[model samples]
Target: MKIAKLSLLFLFLGSFLFAQNQKFTIAEAVNGLRSNLAVKNISQFSWADDGKSYYQSAKNAYMVTDLASHKGDTLVSLYQLNKNLDLDKKLKTFPRITFITKDKGYFTQDSNYFWVERSGKDWKVRDWINIDKEAENIEMLSDNEGFVYTVKNNLYLNRNGKIVAITDDSEENIVNGQAVHQREFGIEKGIFISPDNSKIAFYRMDQTMVGDYPIIDWSVVPAVNKNIKYPMAGTPSHHVTLGVYDIKSNTKRFLNIEGDPEQYLTAITWSPDSKSIFVGVLNRDQNDMKMNQYNALSGNFIKKLFEEQSDKYVEPQHPLLFFPNSNTDFIWQSQRTGYNHLFHYNVDKGLVAQLTKGDWVVTEVLGFNEKKKEIYYVSTQVSPLERHLYKVDWTNFKTQRLAQGVGMHTGILSKDGSQLYDFYSNATTPRVVNVINTNTLKTRNILSAENPLKNYDRPEIKNVTLKADDGTPLYGKIILPTDFDANKKYPVIVYLYNGPHAQLVTDSFPASGNLWYEFMAQKGYIVFTMDGRGSSNRGLKFEQAIFRHAGETEMKDQLQGVAYLKSLPYVDADRLGIHGWSYGGFMTTSFMLKHPDVFKVAVAGGPVIDWNMYEIMYTERYMDSPQNNPEGYKQANLLDKVQNLKGHLLMIHGAQDNVVVWQHSMNFLKAAVDHGVQMDYFVYPGHEHNVLGKDRVHLMQKVTDYFDEYLKK
Candidate 1:
């Protein structure tokens, strides 16, 4: 008995020592999740038009699986595709195929679009169209008769093998078929095809009036100056207008929008009959919006359907979603009730009904079940950190949860809205895919990804909830160092981004938070991240709390997190460090200067030192114009607060950054010199707002080295 017990003890100790033998390299800590340590997932998973089967892409084949039989078959292979095309060069891998019908799909290869159809036992290419090699922002017609694309500053349409120039602007400042307003207000693409595919509406932005800012390319021997149009707050902004091109007549006309030329036009949509177009016209102040319709062919203004007004700011991010079969009524997402919810409206009746209501917000609208008169959506009704699918009866406004699991659930609905391809992940679950029946709420697990970090020694992460100054609940996470000792105190680093439209903490996979945090924890440091006021996923009140004063409330809430850390027995309050990028970079710099005594070390990258130099659309909405809100701008400006710095500060910026511009930190250095303040500065050449790619490992290593040199000492 004694001999057996000794052997068991030896085996246990060997396992424990083996687990502690592994450590993360800087490269693995930075890019491991995206490369070698990436979790398995279904590639190009989508449902067929019949709603009875789904498809996924494999090594060199397209696979289709029947729902009832749970059996899969090869729909097409790279060999079969190349055999049908008879091309000079064969494809090395299967292209991304998107199905428009049950047995028909299309794929693009070398600027050529091929439509493939499945016969009894083989797949064949039915048609093919070749486009320009330099084409961008390509949008194909619904019937596949033609497509539209942009080349440089002009727009072109290829219809029935004929290329037609839609716009012929001589100057480059007049960009056609491109996103304007710096891609604000949820405008991603530039071209919008009509329902009948007979006409196309595109944005024409004239940026000649905007000021020119140079982004120097320092990679060459003689640096080249690349000037970009940058409109500062309260400055001359770009003028954008929409133009409709009729494919049949080969003619175009600009919309007759009766407003200031600089006003924003968003939420663009088309009528079912293709005779009218809808646009949400917002003024320069961004306080009010009018949903108006226009005649498609003549560009004549029709009646205004409705108007929405807000005291803070009216941000319309989503276009009107018309009912599946009805054109007169549609669903509009609004935050009027403090949370984002859906409201039904009619063109003539104005207000129809409020479909979903709660303290939580609806994140997305999946689809509609026309036969059952039900609408499918994903919402935060369970928790702010979790998203689940829900179905609601439009007639009675009764709602029911259809998705299982307590995590971030995202799904794609079939054409008939009967099956949902649900995908989700949580702290304990790496990934889980399910096919859920909407009516019966029956779920079948398709894929449950294994944890990629099972062999590594991970740190312990616990959710931390604290109260704001107003007693509002603020969520965060505290990552304890590996082999933590409660009796021994350790240095702490706070990584935060407390900016608008960003949330740092969530109940997702790799629950130890960012691997970099875990990487630091293994090196004997604790890491903490919190989402304070001005962060997204909360209600409008939570986000707008920092309005007019960008840094005041956010700092206060972050202090709450600081206080919580100081309360812990294992935290060394005197050795606190902080790091962030972009707006978070702005916050990190603000904290170092404004509250210098709080942190011992700080690293800020691509930070905005002055609000006045930021863009007009985003800055004016939060701080108003620099002219109107001079006091707010003066207080938030970090350049004036440079002399207050007392900690070891390292400021970094990208040489080619156009978003925040390099002038922000350069001017701050000028102020630092005048005040006789000592600080460190670094620059990454030939990079943008963020340092990406393999160089990201070097960036994070530099940040880590800075923290280790200052805080660990």
Candidate 2:
């Protein structure tokens, strides 16, 4: 009787454990991210501030190793961190720790700041009130020095326990310490600190001049009008100015840049001495840009280094990269020769030499090694589909490959650039992180992530290469449905975003780069995505092939993909669907109008129906101005071609989309009504550009259902 009771108790424990572990669902996968379903990964692997030691992190623990000795020890214990802190909530894992000095480290638990100091056999923690609770984009200089943050729409500097307001503007339209120019020219942040961190420079965008676009809130008792600052094309744009703040004086001064107020202020950079600041000031027309520098203290214009002008437009995405320990020479990224390459420039000597040149483009510059006079970067030197890390020696300008195997490899270099923590992922490999000693070229494997969705009904994703109309090589990825059979035919779903600066067909894991594609594959749809002409990472010839004709070449190239899809024995040509977002949305509509009989169904999200309605920077770069290229605008406009759309097309928007604007879709609906074209429409309330978060599952479900109802015959 005693043994039977013990067995019953064990069975009860097993049932309780089983109840706690729930099976993953579609909603759980989309919303919760099924955090428990994520692949076990190396949490935070970084070279310590000392440069001689590095740390590899886990959930609750971290291991630090000395490079010279290859000896490692537990650096921080989350258990100890929790014990030292007093809080209402108990922490589960280690915080985001950043080592400032040899002994001091700072971390954050949500928004609360914690500074931990190392003692002999114990760790001491303290709660500091130097940081603002409402601060955003906090860039700290040191442990106790100060930090720069933005609250609401203004800039603030919290220094040595006192918070100083930089911009006291009460208007939300006057945005400070944020990226401007609709996020073009690679302006992601408004804050740029000096090397010494004594002064801070930030962008001040005054969008009060722009028009207000109102959006309604249907979810509320009474729909309210929420107006957004939208600077449309061929209209009055926002004026931007660069301001510098001195910590000692707590004063602000704007740079004396000579240009129209509505012109673009991009590629913000600081001198090594912090005495000067540089900016790429483009004109209102955006066809020309003057790379100029100014005095940081006096706020006076220094000199114009160089100028770039194009009949179409000149876009400056990268900033000035100064040489290590030297301020005289710097590297600049330009696409003057129809290809983006690196150019070495001397402030006094003018253009010294072009460091890198070829048909390929240098995607990103990692860092520079001062001792060895080498700079590391990732480029499309091998192939446009793959990105590999390479080191270019400054002496001879010879390049050496650093990354092993294929796919996109990105790395974080040490302060001295002698060591690197490399991270990579590909279609086959889930993830692989490594530590490399640059001097000896010796590398050690740190962590390799396993396939997280191994238990799911994954599809067979493979890379497909097809030729464009002009015989140019186009790369694409196709997902065969789970339990795919050769005898039975399957419907095709052409998923694409065949626009500039986006290459969907990459050697990335989950092979399609989106889990939604696999989810649709589980529903038995053969998904396809290709990077046609005018897509990024390829040479300028390929990307600019659609110049003056945005949707023409991309559509024709996609037709080549369709021709290849029809050639496949398992593909059903009668039931075909197409899906694209933004530029892809533009292409999807264009294909339906151009082909007519090819696609049976299509779904477009936030697509640009007319180039004139798009932003100035991006639209003008390819199609020039609406005033100049009226024919290109007329040809690409889907508004007039609504009569040609034979497929069942569905256009979805964020309702308040500021990028493409809702007017693009609203205008299309007006034309559709005039032409009496039947179509489907949906909108996600309070969404902009794209419908994200948990609601995105609903968006995809709506899209899947549209194709299922029409094409899944």
Candidate 3:
């Protein structure tokens, strides 16, 4: 149970440096220096409208490829693209280009927009649009004539040559064209444009009644207090309403959605004709949901098409997907049968048929074919630990697996559903890219990447399967220390994020799936990771098992990992340590304090001390309000168990973190002080939520130092 590869370190200075330069050190891995060692990918690839050709930015130029010949040519030279936009051609880098049709493509150089056309065989370029100023969320209309964007927190519509202000409110509480509900329920942008580009729909949120949490900017001489509108659980949340604007008449009307304004309006969708809009309305309690229809032109409430209810919560993350040719028929995803599956529905007949019924989850729905008879998706049907691409027929629910691989896979289909670009990766493989003919299923390897870490002294990684206390199977991975000795004992570190929408252990890349894990093993420590209940990609029961309980059930499942670790003969039980961020941070802190004697040291970053202090949308959906489920809230609250802490614990947070908030760990420190307990604490100045980019190297170094001091020594 050791690293199978030979060490490349030289004989004299053998401890740190490798001979030729293949040392998997922390500085290179965390400072983003090792990114060049990763498998090269054909970035920004786009399928053409013809379904037999594609455009890709590869080898420093945009290349067009024909499927039959398996050959490519330069679509636009970097020099030509830069010269056409009247820019300096200093660095030959390809711009972000997207295909509009078989022969037409659009790209941006600075604020200037350019359109390149495949005139016969040579590319003809012309200036398209000049963005006069900086804007956010710049989304072009379908006709490519105009776009909707945000400037200074207000919505604006630019059609032809005229720029019109869609909203004029100046208050911070009245924000427009930004994500609402704290980015929950899959609401990314607030603006929506109609099919004909004559009307626009946007969200108007009034956070005037919500509380403003103070966030200090420590970079200033005297830290300034910046208040952000944060609605905690059982608190007064913000109210949101949708408004439609008519560009020709310069008129606006609000949709008459009948509900409490604090309730959630999620998964917004428009009909193909743009005459009607569909919205999923969930109450503040999050137990009941109704798919309601509204008239787009008059901004009138139509009728409720269907409803879904659960004792815990019903989350809607996807919009109604209409067929390519039919305006009335659409597909909807639901977990009403204890599993997430797709169902075909008609506007008039309600449920047409259950299209996809399985014990697995459909992770994503790519799109439908041109004929509206088949759909492409990524699902967990092959295995819970692996994702595979598939196409399911709408008529009979016949499924065909695409992009042959044993691990995670994703693919993009052509507009006519003739060509598919399959990109996949697995445990032993670094990366694999393939092109498959959709009709014949004939495949060709475009790029079979070699293992980049082949020369490094890598640790052996093995996936382990165990069972929970409830007889449910659990998936995990164990990484043995590099240059391990069977006769000697080693301290183990359990890294996890066992929460909803978070799955730590997967069947992708090097088995361990994280460089930090391998680095820890190289430092003479075993690393373990597992996805307990309440994690994602399993069926509904696995994901919802921890509802209203939060950390309770996950702890039960994670303890199973601890039991397995303890049973190992070479594992040092007295020196077990744990580390995690966000929810995993919550788990790390909870495991140390709640169990007291199970682990020796723990490092938690941006953890949840009390569930009541969390946001309204995410917290209430899982744990319910403190008023509704007081016992569950009290059980999961870490502040209650601070007196039981018996290990070397370290807590870290960003000074300006607003997601989990700085107050969470700060309050935990206060609780420890009041209970006459001592724990280590650190803060990153001017950082929010997680320390990212180059600063993350510092964060990981601190984490590694704590484990070394408490466990290794």
Candidate 4:
């Protein structure tokens, strides 16, 4: 499938000859770009049982496009019929729908749910089910007999014409249905239901012991101070426990796992028979993890099936499937062999058979086909910079590629796993969805391709592998100007967020800053980004190697990255600058303070000056509590080292940023002011953790001007 949209700005030789750094037209840049770009992170697509595809196209409209249709004349509406009951009239706007029911006819919008049924050419609102109070993220059970959902912290079940509240004491201090900040960082929800719909398992986070970070919401008169339970590095985390509730018995039992409640209770799953629940528990230090099975009825500890120990931190995902007809065999992902691999475990025997072993990381688990004995997944096996669809045999650990694409591939499998709608793309390839028959592994339909960046003459971004001082192969991207000249000694802008939880390198389109980078590069400056040490997706040790020394090791890798950049003949070592946001902001601040001479200019947005000021959960996980590791926290604190700041610095933040609280910026502003340090700062009122929409362009302009004034010679 090929999308013929116009690439953003035309690579006009005249534009370059004019010597005017502006090559990419923002209109052409944003025009050919897919609207999906704005909605990609939120939009979801699901394949119907009969193979029809349904997805969200706008804020409230659900589009049903026939993959079999070559013309792409798709049916789009609000997922509901017109108010006047006419098929030709426009559909009424509704609140955004989140999770869709397994039946595909119904979907949940906030707390209310409605079903659509086809009546000839018109779609009718078949049923509107309200489970009372404001609910969120609702989904029907696999049995289709009831629904499981979350309302704030409470879990609910609506079945047999009644709404059942599964959890009662779901207050601010005691959370049951929702995931914590860590889960948000990990990008996974914290609730699941048993296949039979008889049992529901959820993560209950006890934040009563956690520290409350104050975020003053200034929109209100006199400023209303809101206490948000945010656990930062070196602080006590929220106590977490797993609980199972049985609907028939009206009983709730907490699992009998022994450990610090403040630790992480992650990757919860149920056995196929619904008789037992499996959990992956990682220690607070995250160096050790244990996989245990618990008896669902008695809430008794069945056994510790497996244990994975790492010198660094351990990351656990949802434990793999335990096929119903088979024994307690599951697939678990581990980086014990230095590369992430899948291991098939026999729980009863306590034996783990390595399933998929190689030098690649399983990017994500798509699904498991029990009947076909195939484990479908997306992996970086193709290349570290790209993802591909692959299927592995459950019995033999043999793997086969399902999609042939030299880019990132994400797939949605059919209900029966017989077909898949595969989405593939790269820096150059706009997103294209292709329907394929998984059984025959043949492309059935070329569906939709949307390119939002078609008209922009975007600069070419090339993925490069640079070795760290320790010989760790680090992946990064070099973004250059459209009129780049190797003969010129260009200033270098090092974009970094070398933290443990995030990765920056992917086969995706460059950011809007590519234009800014292009402008800088045209002005004889080079822009680069690297996924340094402590960045995720490699494995436990590679990431947690920064443990207890959060900023130290990350800085080493980034410094190595800077040295690598210096090796380029066109790069000017004396004209290096760095910028980052949040943890990246913390990195920027720490780097600028610790090695002031290395950077000419720096920008830190929403930085954490001191770990002691951070919340309890996240801070303690990495640095332990200040009461325990005052020295580690002190060493990582940017405030103490600010005295060494000799570089030009710019601090930017959102006034309403609850995550890093504006005080993080305010504190640094005060410290820098007291020290008589020259600094520039900006704040976006009414903005939260991020600046978006039209403000983004203005922010970009501000960034360009600041960097140009400070770093450009």
Candidate 5:
């Protein structure tokens, strides 16, 4: 009897102590992940050229550690870098460094590029170059010979110390050396340097035919109008062409790509010998693609390597990766098998072999091992929610998993593909960085990040899985209120972004998914999130289910989540709330107006009210065109459904948003007024798309206040 009494007393004391722990403030919940509550990590972690050592930035210094001995030494300090550069005011931190060799690296400070070399027990700045302060989209040559940059609407090459004008187009409408196609089709940069460093290929876009749109800056005395070229769906788009500039001859020529001017040119690649270029030419309808090879010097079409066609759409996002030492064969990433897989193609023969095949997709290709004929890549073969590292033999198609973690794993391979630097995180693990020997599968943990929220009164998070109407397994997370009581009912908030190219339910740190969700849970609200069918990383079939009709299938999956939530005895079904941003914002608005009796409150930011007003690249790829699918657009458009809204809806938008545009919300307001419907609206002046930085705390606070006012009441 005495021992049992003592046990009860100790248990009471432990519960009291746990309840006294910290709780996240609105500001902390909004920005703590990047600041006070940030997980400790090895900053700028990279592998050495030899794969025997690795480098990282720490304590304002760059350090390298040997993998065999696990011994570390400081390579360069901020003091040495500042002293070598002769800066008037010392730099506060070490600049980001990229290693070209074991002893040579380069870093940029301000507009100056500094190349450094390892000296005797120290480092010294060997060479440097200064470009214009206004230069954008800078691409440096691999050999450190020169760089290409764009100023305003032209391209310039800085070779050694000489600056040459590569393009001198006068019209701003005809932009040179910049990303085109609204930055779609996996095109991130405009410049591509050849292997031999003798030629440069860049994109030149002419947007004179595109419609001009104005973004107003109300901060000025009399609001200033900034004009931007915007191509709506089924409208004329910017014309893009590839241009090659020969460094030695100082002459430029356009590739002989015969197609519609507005057709997309993606998957740019250079032949190993630097004498040929390959491009994936996609038509404006985005249903057909052709891989064509062209002569580099003469700008002549060599041959059509291959052709891919799809009844829906053939979207090629990755460039063709050539073999290490051969130009006759290359690896192509395609969704031909309903999943993104690797296909080996030869220059003379059509298809050599399929390197990888499965229901899962290869997320990224790290590098190749020439001697062993192997390729390193990241894939979802283990599970759709987790990413793992694997290496495959290109010759025989035998694959082996390298990392032993059940989470999202990303890696950097060494020069010979013998070592892999694996970095990953899971629900319980904040972060872990490991160095693994590919041959032996021996692992060494270099970093194990401590949980940043250990002291906080965190809510109990659980993984929830439900089957869709078509019996597809859908993953979700539910964060119960702090010090949960199963007997008492709780209000629920479903935070979701059920759109393309995004997956919310991942095996990442903080099982609550987002910090803001955890914050709301502490305030006695249950937070839930799920990845619907339209989300990415599944396969072509799962994603294409929402084709032509954007919100129908996704809504079916979300309703399954709703059914699961309502089935729980502790859920207060009448007080449910919803929130999302961008594509998520569209989802939130769609749910509120379509299912008026389900949710009681919603906060949507930067919602796409109409698909016809969106940009051409993304809009047409999924919904075709307004003229092509009028009924689909009419059904998805929120303007006609304004009268059906019965919830406490708060719509937010960035006044100068260029991505979704401010008109999406403004037009919705006009329609609501015309239809005699009432809703709350807010605007963040001088902000774009999403409200970020310190002001984000205010935005989240407003959202939290709305939930507290309506749902809690």
Candidate 6:
């Protein structure tokens, strides 16, 4: 009778727990997030030269809104523009506007080859002559009479009554046009148009040497494999070469930079005079990098302005800024000082001057205002946990905070660098976007002020710094339950993603947390994440300390975090579990496999089982080639350490992950199976690296059930 009463009591609690865990629907959560989604997610907003009006994309058309009057008018339909100058005149009736110009008013068009110019609300068709050619990439360059367009990857000049091909290289491998994925994902456009349409520097990605990885498409009648040139880790990546085309002479010449064929030519930009083009070349190991300059027309190597070397790795993400009204100068961001700092180099003398120096790292280089001799950028200087906008004098390095907020803030300065549009947010405060004056640091107008998660109850998130085994400072965060109790002992879940280019502990409210952490906390689980060594926002040395041993150093920091959590009187060490996705997933599984006694449960999602399975660009920089560093590769492979697995491990992966690939999870699954290790597994069919939409709900529910079953009750 006593056992039956206890069983009834347990049954009631289980029912209540299940009900509580399944309160919100995925659609409801998505809807709520979407409704309160950051309003300042403006992709590309252009202001008029006078700064009186700005053009923004809304719905299907580009709308020009007057900042002074708050009045907006439809400029063009972005979907209606074509390259062959074949635009349907019918699109004009639909308020079609692709892009607008300040001096030329508005540019409107439809998919066919019809472009119209609007002056004072009056529209006039500028180009209506339909030739027997199919238009593809139509672009309006400057306020000049001639417009630049491309047909079948061949650039052309369309003006008055003549259409001339500036680039005749229409071969399959020698593409002279712009590519979407190359531009969007790689954040670089294949085409570079000169300011005055005198020359064009375009990217030519020769994939003829690349081996194609087959992608299976099961949606067809007979599932067929599609060939894609996916350069895996340690493999020969696609060769990218820059080609400069002269519009007047219709001549094309490739820049002759001194480097190996496999070396990466990144951050290609034209000097102020446009006579020379600058290129940063990085070797495969990514340890050595050089900034080379070459004549745009003659293709002659001009000068090697700046060079950087690191014991582990070096990255060339910052663009070389050419100061106006000066002959010998360019700005570069480097981690040579142990932290990412700005440096000015003279082209004539090849002398480098450190512009900004500190322990804080510059997150981004917004731009250099030559007139004021000031450099504006975003950095984590205020506090490593939060990012803020800052302006510094290029000469004296006098720093000033543009947006004085105790949160993650980002801003976009006007074209003239007089005004800035700022967005600020934190874990508790929703994002707010406002226009501010750069000189006075005063806000002009608030574009948006809405709380994304105002309705939902938010957890109390706090930052905590812990010491690693070597006594190095490690930053971490803990998200407490809505109704947190310090007296009760709770199971702890350590969220991790301690990769070189990642930082989990931040002031910004984590979008992935949702009710999941809250649900866990409600079930008496302590959730925490630590930005271990090799994580981003830290100095180059701090980040590269784990080179060749990605998990070794990170695992130490994480274990330190675990020890810190264990020190908390309310933390149940026996019920400790670790969870991570991608790189974090690798670390989690590696931790559990390496130290199984420390963790009771672990979940590694879409993890890279071996470093050999990752992408060449990122993987080679840290772990080198698998052939060269066999021991390092062996150490990175969690499969090799699977024998130490004693925890209840749950492995999850998307069936069609092209990034980490499903093969990684499959290999681990096979290894665990062969080793007679009991493990739980799940796969989201037709999902890629990240599982979203309706399927994500099921995934979260599964994760919740897994953690609740093992770590909670």
Q: Each candidate's root-mean-square deviation in Å?
A: 2.1, 4.8, 4.0, 5.6, 2.8, 7.2
Q: Residue 611: error of model 6 in Å? A: 1.1
How far does residue 571 in candidate 2 sit from its true spot (Å)?
A: 2.4
Q: Candidate 3 — worst ten consecutive residues by lDDT sum?
A: 1-10
What TM-score would candidate 1 get against the native? 0.97
Candidate 1 structure quality by residue, lDDT tens digits, 332-389: 8888889999999998899899999989989899999888889999999998888999
All candidates' TM-scores? 0.97, 0.91, 0.95, 0.85, 0.96, 0.84
TM-score of 3: 0.95
Model 6 over residues 1-713: C-alpha lDDT tens digits? 99999999999998776654443343444333554343345545666655667776677566777766678886655343222234553343344344446424334333324455654544454554343256555565564455566666566667654777767764554455555223311335566676566787876666667666666666677887766556777777767778888877878888887667777777777776768888878887778888888998899998787788887777777667766666568777778888988888888887567887899998887765556888889998888888988888877878898876677888776666776677777776556676666776667554555654444545677678998777879988787765678887878888889986677767765433344665566555678988888898888767887888778998888888888888988788899988989998898899888888999988889998988877787788788888778888888888777778888889999876788878888888888889988899998877888888777778877887788889886
- State the lDDT of candidate 5 residue by residue for 1-713, as single tens digits: 99999999999999878766789999889999999999998888888888889898888888999988999998788787667555654567777888787678898878888887877766787548898889999999878888899999899999887999999998899998999999999999898899999999999999999999999999989899999999998889999999999999999999999989989999999999999999999999899999999999999999999999998888999989988888899999999999999999999897999999999999999998777889999999999989999999999999999988788899999888889989999999999999988888999999999999988989989999999888889999999999799999999999988888999998988777789999999999999999999899999988888889988888888989889999999999999999999989999999998888989999999999999999998988888888899988998999989999998999999999999999999999999999999999999998999899999999999999999999987
Model 2, range 1-713, lDDT digits (tens) per residue?
99999999999997776654334355544543336555556767677765798877765767788877888888878777777667864567667777765467887765667778788767777765545677887877643577788998999887767778989999899999988888898888899989878789999999998888876676688777788776655668889999999887878899998768988998899999889999999987777999998999989998999999976667788999998999889999998987888898988778988888788899999898998999988888888877888889887999898869788888889888888888888887888988888888899887798877655667888889998777888898889988699888999999989898888887766577777787778788899988999998887788878877899888889889999999999999998999999999999888888788999999999999988888777887788777877898899988888999888999999976878888899999999999988899988878989888778879888998898899998
Task: For candidate 3, give the lDDT of residue 58.
Answer: 69
Clash number for every model? 0, 0, 0, 31, 0, 18
Q: lDDT of each structure?
A: 0.91, 0.84, 0.85, 0.72, 0.91, 0.73
Off by over 4 Å in 3: 1-22, 31-34, 83-93, 117-127, 132-134
Model 3 lDDT per residue over 669-690, tens place: 9999999999999999989998
Q: Which regions of candidate 5 are displaced past 4 Å?
A: 1-20, 82-92
